[model samples]
Target: MDAIPYLNIILRLTIWFLLTADLSVANIIIGISIAFLLPRHFASPEPLREWMRVLWEIIIAIPQAYLEAIQIMLRPHDEEEIVRERVKPKRTPGLIFLDIFLITFTPKTIVLKYEEQGWYKVHRVRRKISDQ
Candidate 1:
């Protein structure tokens, strides 16, 4: 049920990012090539009302997230150990709200990388302190 909405968002983002990054004739060729390689994803059948509710939730969440980014920037980190202190509790994969907070707030300084716990690699992002 929930998975269907998430996939729709992800594919929309993918198409947007690709389109924004390139618009040349070659880009269209690459897009066509990608269409062949892409697998058909199944979205569970869900009610239209449920879908509308999910879409509204997503719309509201985006601006609040950017506001959080502002707050993270306004608040200062205590020290280097703070990073280690922050992530100690999680036993499984997927970005926590704060992890997404950092990524959203500081996209320039962060990078997402694959991590393996077993057969599946959980998505994680980390920020590097840079020397300027």
Candidate 2:
């Protein structure tokens, strides 16, 4: 496989430096060296629109998650009241991983199992009729 281009190497190095919070000359040199050495076979950039959509979903999910978590904690736990459902299948592994991470933020909902055919067994705290 061809080595990743210089632009991508620089981009990854910069990101590595930022994430590590080590901007010293020695670290920068090491980052650059590792960036060039690492394989970038799966570095496909996502479209701007997809990133925006993901951001919007996160913005909406945050408040919903907080509210649901509070409700779950306040209510008495009942095994019979838990809900189970399978969500739609995601086309890509990245999307599946993202969905799992995002949805698990809410305490009311927990992913119990993941299987092929997009089958995800989720446990959800039952909502009160008044809250519904």
Candidate that scores best on lDDT = 2
lDDT per residue (tens digit) for residues 1-132 in model 1: 557445444545456456669767876666656654665444334444544554465566677667656655776433332122234233222223224333433422332432343222223233445589
- TM-score for each candidate, following the candidate numbering: 0.40, 0.53
lDDT of 2 by residue, 42-121 (tens): 64654445545655786788999888767778886454343445654333444454466566766667777767766667
- Candidate 2 C-alpha error for residue 3, in Å: 19
Q: lDDT of candidate 2 vs native?
A: 0.63
- Residue 24 in candidate 2 has what lDDT? 87
- List the RMSD of every prediction in angstroms: 8.8, 6.6
Q: lDDT score, residue 73, model 1?
A: 77
Error of 2 at 110 (Å): 1.3
